[model samples]
Target: QEELAKKQAEALKIQKKNDELRAREEQRHLAKNTRVFELPLSRYKRKDDLKDIAACLGLDLNGKIPELTSRIKAHLDSNSVLQANPRFCGLFG
Candidate 1:
């Protein structure tokens, strides 16, 4: 009976640990999902187009395509004046 009690205690400890880990993982997933980003620019049909978009967004040319696109979207979202610009709107929207 003593051994059974010890085993039950161990099991309870492991179960509690597992529950904590699950909760932490769920929190991480929720945080990731809640993050807001956007893809402002479409695909580049030419290399020059890619350069122009990066220049216009003030993002580094070395950044990945998706990251640059997201930054551009965020910029446009924050700056209504940029959104109002005909050239900027034509390129991104």
Candidate 2:
């Protein structure tokens, strides 16, 4: 009976952890989706700022600000198109 109780307690802890991870993932998804199309030019004032955005987008980070801006814009545009299409999303979603 003591062993069973310990196992049950462990299971409860694991279950709670899984629930917390699931909730965190859902929040991240919501935040990413919410900011998908709301890019403002004024937000990226410095070259480092643009580099950070480029790195997040998986673009080459070795470029001038204007080049980085264009690359990020292009990537965002393509992603937005894919996101806007329900068929494309359903295939991989």
- For model 1, how does the per-residue alpha-carbon lDDT over 42-84 read when each residue is reduced to its tens digit? 6454444454555655556456666666666677678778656
Model 2 TM-score on a 0 to 1 scale: 0.43
Q: Residue 57 deviation, candidate 1, in Å? A: 3.2
Residue 64 displacement (Å), model 2: 0.5
Which portions of model 2 miss their true places by more than 4 Å? 1-39, 81-93
TM-score of each: 0.43, 0.43
Over 6-58, each residue of candidate 2 has an lDDT whose tens digit, in order, gives 99999999999999978855654454433342346446668855665555456
Which window of ten consecutive residues has the lowest lDDT sum in model 1? 31-40
lDDT of every predicted structure (CA atoms): 0.59, 0.62
